[model samples]
Target: MPHTGHHLRAVFRRPDFRRLLSARLTFQGADGVFQAGLTGTILFNPDRQTSAMAIALGFAVLLLPYSLIGPFAGVLLDRWSRRNVLIIANIVRAAVVPAVAAMIWVGIAAEAFLPLVLIVVGGTRLVSAAVSAALPHVVDEKELVTANSFISTAGGLAYAVGIAAAMGLRPLFGASDHGYAIIALMSVLGYVGTALVIRKFTPNELGPDDVPDSGGVSVARLAWHELRTGAQHLAARKNAAGALLVVVGMRVFFGAALIAVVLLYRNYFTADGFFRTHETGLGQIMFASAAGNLIAAGITPAATRLFGTRQWLGMLLPLAAAAQLGLGILFTMPGLIAASFLVAIASQGARLVAETTLQTECADEYRGRVFSVFDTLFNACLVLGLVAGAAFLPETGKSYAALIVISVGYGLLAAGYLWLSRGSTLPVMPAKPKTEPAQALTQLR
Candidate 1:
């Protein structure tokens, strides 16, 4: 609790951290613009026929493979220059996204759409992994908690700004493939800006041991071996591992809720002028959720301090569960939107605690790989939730059964967390003593 204020200000003062934050904000803001356009065009459009399974497939296409790919590719972050990865990945994305946007504008087949979306989405995930891995390089470990909070919150707000921009422009441009192409094209340029921003950092600022070479097996074997090593490191840290599981649980619950909300807004809500259309209504709900996410970052540290990190996380999980079921009971317009805000806060708050815990508890050497594993779990669970919603939700998106399942699932997560940490009062890990970034970079070269 003490010095938290000073530390928050101190985080903003670091020049390199500011550059890193700029990279993240620019990239994520572009992502928001791209996503908002896509959702408006494909998912929420009243003119287009959409289905639950179709929605599931669309989401799974963007997310699920990255789950498989993150850890395997994380070996790159550890072994290669992460700054280069950031630069190259964003550049590649800048090239690829316009192609994807073109396909959307031309009304490509579903099969074609998925593959292109995969390339762009996969690149985005890599950029995100690189940022998380490189984060400790710019800021002191003492500031890691607040730094992560500020960085993530700023990223979310940037994303919301992007979404708002899409909303504002859609009327002028029309919510069609042309509009999607235009918005996504702009994001491509934003990705290039992100590339230039990361250029401020040196090649080796991010990390892996600076061994000159490796006596190795095949590349796949090497990647598998490295992933296993990361798993072992994560396995050794019980509380960090537990926290990750909790975050994954949150993703699953919200993933299902997301699909449900999309369907609910699309079909069940009266389009007879109360909100004008489902897209407008859903956009507002998402905006509220985004605001809650931004707000959560500010509150998480204090909440964790008042109730220990593990305890605070334990409380948030059930609150999320209650929010889900409460929405089930209310099952009305204002109710759904308001409940979404509450659920968003709990989920985002819980997620921040997990990120801070993993970043702090894991050693620097293994940080990238651990984050990869966490992201993998996160994507997989989210895909699973989306698929589950597809299975349970009707065309109307009103499924009491699905809500019950989501609530029970979150309840199990809450109970599981409290049960695991029942007797032991585990302490949070502070930043480890380390060489300065300049010295680390010197050694790296």
Candidate 2:
């Protein structure tokens, strides 16, 4: 399983990988649709009547719960059948989207939509956990990095395409509640498609490998203990723990930048109030940022090879810091756009590499718990960043103080990253699972 020119091609042609890819693409594609549809109702809609605080509040509420208890809840993924989790989660999403869509058709969207979106986001997060846990099951251990790169990068591209399509599709549907309703419904195809794709997987194929002699610990008890367990696990792997911290710190800065970008485009960058509504403006910038993600996907594997994971990650933190400072001082439309792309590259590059580190460093039995911790911190940091931005951003998103504070924060983060990554390297071999037959598994029988 050493590197080969055709190895990537071989991975794709694999039947199980193909099915999983179908599930991923369809789900991610739908995520684009769901997001695009919501834009008309929330983020970018000119008619929606939003303010800087409102946008930040919306995201904060949406992601906060997952971050708080998400890891503990995510431990269920290891105990439950991953196959059923994907299958049930996707189908349930398909069944539920139309209800939200129907609510959109009424004027109650402001009240009802956020809650509905919360459900949709929950389902999406669950599916994501299942997929990440299941991935190692489908591909060879040696191929984890490249395989993940292809899957993640391609899924991101698919999501961007969905967002781009939503831009046009909403207008065709008239960019109103009714229009959003139609777009909301479009996500159903992805959910249903993914559910069907996952049906091909036998129940235990995705695995915890069935730990025996458990002393019959209740799942509820396991849940209570899992977070502590995950923390202890991380404490032991200093480099792995450091890598997770790097991602968390990066997200704090990322959140503030998001607020700045939204404020800049929505209120400030309307081509002197002549062209580009906030919706279009945000979309244009998102497309550009997404393109940076695609570019990162292509280069990260090679970059990791040359620089090594710790060194590459250490370098990315400072680069993102530099970009934020440039955007803060320059504060021009072009500068804002450039900052968006640079951050996207740095963020995606860091995440992809960090994920590879996690999968390789942590034992398979604890991966779900580990990822849950990862997801919880990942999301919690986003809210923290947004909250920070809201505190500093003016109505127009043009506060120099805000920019300076963010830049200073990024400088601190970069310093911490340097301290952590000083002499470490990504381990070549995966950590061994502690238990025999490792953990839990489920069978239809």
Tens digit of per-residue lDDT, candidate 1, span 142-185? 78777887888788889888888878888887777777668767
**Cα shift from native, residue 99, model 2 (Å):** 1.3
Candidate of highest TM-score: 1
lDDT of 2: 0.74
Which structure among the candidates has the greatest lDDT? 1
Q: CA lDDT of 342 in candidate 1?
A: 80
Model 1: residues with Cα > 4 Å off, grouped in runs: 209-212, 271-276, 429-445
Weakest ten-residue segment in model 2 by summed lDDT: 436-445
Report the number of clashing residue pairs per model: 0, 2
Any runs in candidate 2 off by more than 4 Å, and if so which? Answer: 1-6, 212-216, 272-275, 426-445
Residue 1 of model 2: what lDDT?
A: 26
